[model samples]
Structure formats: structure tokens, C-alpha cells
Target: MPDLASLVTVPALLASVFFFIAGSVGLVRMPDTLTRIHALTKADNIALGLLVVALLPQVGSIADAAKIVAVWIVVQISSGAAAQLMGEVALAERDAASSGPDQRGMAGGRDA
Candidate 1:
């Protein structure tokens, strides 16, 4: 029979892989940029965190685990910020595209 370490790490790693696959499917099936970002940031980040957790038991020391956790935390924060920025840009692009050159400014003394 396998040991406790294998039991924990195996499932955790499997879960991480599942999340990554789900995120990829979501990205392809989704309609637009905002949705894709949602899939990636939410699903992929979870996958990354789980991957870190799975590797934690195999690391040489507690300090290595701490470092992994720190990296994961940083990734979470940065990904959230990036998603927000991408969302804003997507909205801006949509607005600009809808406006068109003529609608943007029809001129002060001209009629539609």
C-alpha cells in the first residue's frame, strides 16, 4: 500500500490538473474577453494554489512551504488587479467601437 504523503499529494495534484483543464474549456467556450479573464483568473489561480499545496509536503523544510504560500498569495493579488485592468480596457474598447468616428464628435455647429 502507498503512504500518507502519496495519498494527499496525488489527489491535490489531480485536482489542480482538473481545474486547469476546466479553465481552458471555459476560455474557449466563453463569448468574450471579460469572460475569458474570469475563467483564467478564477480557475487557473485555484489550480496554482492547489498545485502549491500538493508540493508543500514534498519540500525539504517549513520555510520552503512558507515561500510557496507567499508566491501563491502574490499571484492571487496580481491576477485580480490584472483582471480589473483588462475589464476596464474591454469596456473602454466597447464604448469606443460603439461611438465610431462620427458619433464621437459631430462638431459644435453641425447637424446630424
Candidate 2:
């Protein structure tokens, strides 16, 4: 019979692998940078969370689990926020590019 620890670890590892694959596909198939970031972040967050949870049983300590969870939370927040910021920046750049060169204060235009 398979041991409990093995059972837990195996499933967790499999889930992490699946998340990684999904993320990779999204990164490749998505049409834009913002969409790609969304996919990548979701995959990374799920994979890391699963991996950490899998390690909890092996560590066999509450303190270790707490530390891992804390780190995971930090990673999740930082990555999500960074992705949002990047998306905003990309959108701003796209808008600017589409606006064309500025015509203000040129050819005797008003300069107020």
C-alpha cells in the first residue's frame, strides 16, 4: 500500500506540474502581454502554493508551515500587484503609440 505522505506528495507534485503546463500554454497562446501576465501569475501562484503545502507534511512542524505560508502570501501579493502595474503601463504605452506625434505648439499653434 502507498504511504500517506507519498500519496499527498504525489498528488501535490502532479497538480503543480499541471499548473506549470497551463501557465506555459497561456504564455504562448495569449494575444497580449497583459493576458500573458494573468495566465503566468495564476499558474505560478497555484504551483507554488501546492508545492509549499506538499512540503508541510515533510517538515512536520507548525512553525515551518507558517513560515512557508507567509512567504507564499508575500509572493502572491507582490506578483499580482506587479502584474497589474505592468498591465497598466502597457496599456498606457499602447494608447500613447496610437495617439501619434504631438502637434501642439507647432506651425504657429497656441502655446498657452
Per-residue alpha-carbon lDDT of candidate 2 for residues 1-112, written as tens digits (9 for 90 to 100): 3377778888898898899899999999998887898899989789988888677677667898899889988998898899999999978876665553453423543222
Write down the lDDT that model 2 would get. 0.81
Which candidate has the highest TM-score of all? 1
lDDT of each: 0.85, 0.81
Indicate the TM-score of model 1: 0.82
Q: Which ten residues in a row have the lowest lDDT in candidate 1?
A: 103-112
How many residue pairs in model 2 have overlapping backbones? 0
Flag clash pairs in model 2: none
Error of 2 at 105 (Å): 15
